[model samples]
Target: MSEKKNTNHGPQKGGPMGGFGAPVEKAKDFKGTIKKLLSYFKPNLVKVILVFVMAICSTIFSIAGPKIMGKATTKLYEGVYGKIALAKLNTQKVSLEKIASMSKTPNPKVSGGLAAIKAGIAKVISETGGKIDFTYIGHILLMVIGLYLVSALFTFVQQYVMAGIAQNIVYDMREDLSTKLNKLPLKYYDSKTHGEILSRVTNDMDNISTTLQQSLTQLVSSVVTILGVIIMMLTISPILTLVAIVTLPICGIATSGFAKKSQKYFAGQQKAIGELNGHVEEIYTGHNIVRVFGREQESIEKFEKINDELYEVGWKAQFISGIVMPVMNFINNVGYVVICVVGGMFVIKKKIEIGDIQAFIQYSKQFTMPIVQTANIANILQSTVASAERVFELLEEVEEIAEDKQPKVIELPKGEVKFEHVKFGYKENVTLIEDMNLEAKPGQTVAIVGPTGAGKTTLVNLLMRFYEINDGRITVDGVDTREMTRADLRGMFGMVLQDTWLFNGTIRDNIAYGRDNATEEDIINAAKAAHADHFIRTLPEGYDTILNEEASNISQGQKQLLTIARAILANPRILILDEATSSVDTRTEIFIQKAMGNLMKGRTSFVIAHRLSTIRDADVILVMRNGSVIEQGNHDELMKKNGFYADLYNSQFSDGEDVG
Candidate 1:
């Protein structure tokens, strides 16, 4: 066996919620993860369907709006420039198609242009008697304005309904994730950091929320606009429609290339950011240690390195994604030029009207925009799917072993506990505690002491059922602990650890947390028992003094006192005190020890202490080494035996060796 030391190795690995900076590991089952994410949409299916429908309606009106407005432009052009100009032409040998062709040529129109115009005027006079339509122009203008207004209203309705659906889905996700966190095993969290878990819950959920709110609608609108614009353009002129479609293949190739590069950079950028944030967290959490050691320069140097890496990846990711716009814009301009030239030829031939040519140009612009927005939305969805992967990972984490189907409750008994033939280890193929046996009768105080990692806390963890034993059985009042529900077994004990925990709430609330529905009187009495009431009363708000987020306003000793008060309020049949007075001053230590003694009266207790003196008065002392009990006796009895316990005890006083 390896020699044991009084040290903790710290926590293990775990999972996340999504944000921009999560590491770039591909989830094990990508398709399965997406399927799980989609399952959440089941409850909101109706609302989601409504959102898509509204989106389609909104996009259709917006697409048609540009074409409708072209009517006004055509009317003004024909009334002021075309009809009156045509009235002056004479019908000899002229045609508008031939005139348009000659306008683009060098010098062919010099002699025939005047005679051709006279011929066109003669033709127009025969058709309309040299009159121009003015009343029809005004009516078309009103209709165009009304189309724009309706389009605006549909878009508003679509967005409003989508907002509610997206937010509600996000709410359900957070709620479900919270429940999953509670159900996860202790070791799962032991493996990961707080920031990682928070990212999966907050950042990832936000990604999903934003995607549902915006991307879904954008996706629907992009499709509707693309199709609607194609049909509109075809009606005006098939040649122009073909010109517009020709650029799509070029855009597609460019888009595919940029997307691959951008996604690669995006993943790298997120990973670098995660590493940088981790460095910041580590530096800040150990800021005091850093100051004491004067390692500020080294810390700063480390930060700079990480920051430089982040800048490299972040710049590349952004640059790659941004290139998509300029590339697509170039392709669209190429198509636009072709369409305008072809449409002009059709107009002169009288194969299509000037109004139709204007409408087709507007349709072309509207169509190109949806393609751009859709491509951008594709990138957004990639990041969102990354977020969903995180949420899925968290939801899929392994939970604690199932509770007994026919469960027993810890009821109607004295506080007697027993551990028999227990064997366990944190990792498989290495048993730290093997075939161990122990007992604590009703009202007896059992103190377990050992070097760190010798399974001192591990024993308490087994008793609390935070971890399961590899073999044998633990019992409370002669009933096997495994048979009893975990909730019931845990409910019988009240524990106080070395580190105190207090939330952002009043002093009274922190104390009252030990018991459900505890009244003010119950809180006050528990505080008095733990000797925390006097200082609490001295505060500005007495028991109502609010603790800040970190509870840093109070001293360490005061926080310990509050935790003791919380335990006192619980008043459980079994008590476990773990170095409860380790960090306090000697005077506060005395008060804590006294409160602990009072608290232990008539209750079965287990004390895990580093200070041997604190456990000297324990009913039984179980000395542990490498996960086995090497000595078992009261203080005086162990002193007489003069073995391992003697060295441990004498080390504390003989030469002032820090046995603790």
Candidate 2:
């Protein structure tokens, strides 16, 4: 056999940055992603509208406060103007008569205005015994305070409502994707790494949650503020409004140019993040192998490369979006300068009030502020849409070819099984298994012995429906397996693989996973039959001993025994042992073999073994090579023939070392 390189565990080879560098896509379908995202919020339609109202009311109230405050400024200025005697040089208490005589230009209006002011002051002094009337100013300040208070209340309500809505949508989306996972075909998961799938479920969902609550509401409020400010500015002076309008084109050019350039980078960032996650997950899960091979530094280097790529793209995307503010600030300064100059002229010409100019300046700031925000929000929307597109893409993946419209159920299954003219390949147009045929009679041990890459595991995968065969039929008890529900068909068989899989749970809980409703007595009996009861009793917590995250607390041999115990407890009608004793020590192999022997009694059993000594007693032996069964017979019969099986069996002991 040709030896392959040992570079499989690291980042993919022969690509930019060792394949960690992400590809760039042009014109991502943000519109479609956004439309699909809206559907998720449909269930909260009424609450969404209420949230919108809250935002609008909050913003409107706050927007109106500035105009009202401008009134207060106008009143205060006019009151001071009325009281001042600009021309009077000296006086004991300059009465209206002395000030009138001293003023040359103000004499015409001073008498009437001073009489009105004196009469108002006297009226207030008569009512409350005060020389000055502060009641009007107090009322205006109080009104402005009330408007702001209401605005604060609306803002609070908006956040509360939107938070619940966004979270619920997130929950529902996660729930849906999780449910879809169980229904998806084994091939779907086989093609995707755990980290890639997890990235979509966790990171993408969080993005949607944040953008839905913050960006969505920001978009709405900014839009409303822009429109309302425009109207207010126009009311003050259309000429100044035109001056502010000039900034729109500059903003459009900058935002559009940046958005188009940076949007792809943002999308690439999310994808790279997923790729980085996949790399981390793969390495961490196999950290033991990395240490054994002393490849820690190599792993770290690959990690740094991916991390650097992620940072590079992420920085560019964020920096490009960040430009919007400074660009708008420049635009806003120019726009405000023009509006201020024009409004100042209007005020001097007496065409607009000083109060109106003050309000318009505030309005102009308010208007451009939203324009800046809207542009910023637009860039955020691009990233958000990119994340949403990934989520929707997962949701759109073709689920396991749907179950039959009317799937049959095997109420009872016999152990007899057959595979006829089977054909399969992992990829299109590349055939792996062809014209395959096999059978296992009830109560017979069928041992499949094969060279490496001889398609033994692929055959088992096909039988279990992990992957559908390209052509041909698989049958159990003379009934086509496809006709029966996959769950019902699979429940009839138990599998103990070369790699032991025990989740984090108590010793009892992990064993009980095979048969959840099993009584304690049944569990103990199965453990005893597997010869695993002694170890269970020796543990500190006995059968209830809890396993750590990776079940690393126990020995590999012990874990294998527990799995054997589980299969025994399941009491399946058909048994499959795929190198089941591969992990166990020599002494423990005796117990595991005895247990497997008992479990296989009176059941159809298929033993896939590399050790010829282990399966010498099989009722039938099939020698396989290059995806086809080449020979089949009892051990003695195959040895007499001195064919492929004979040479394979004899080669193991060729050095007189009795290798199995």
Count backbone overlaps in model 1. Answer: 20
Clashes of each: 20, 0
**517-552: candidate 1 lDDT, tens digit per residue:** 999999999999888999999999999899998899
Estimate the TM-score of every prediction. 0.85, 0.81
Q: Give lDDT: candidate 2, residue 216.
A: 86
**How does model 1 fare in lDDT?**
0.79
**RMSD per model, one decimal:** 7.6, 6.7
Off by over 4 Å in 1: 1-28, 86-135, 251-272, 305-324, 654-660
Question: Which regions in candidate 2 have their CA more than 4 angstroms from the true location?
Answer: 1-27, 85-133, 247-349, 404-409, 655-660
lDDT of 2 at 342: 83
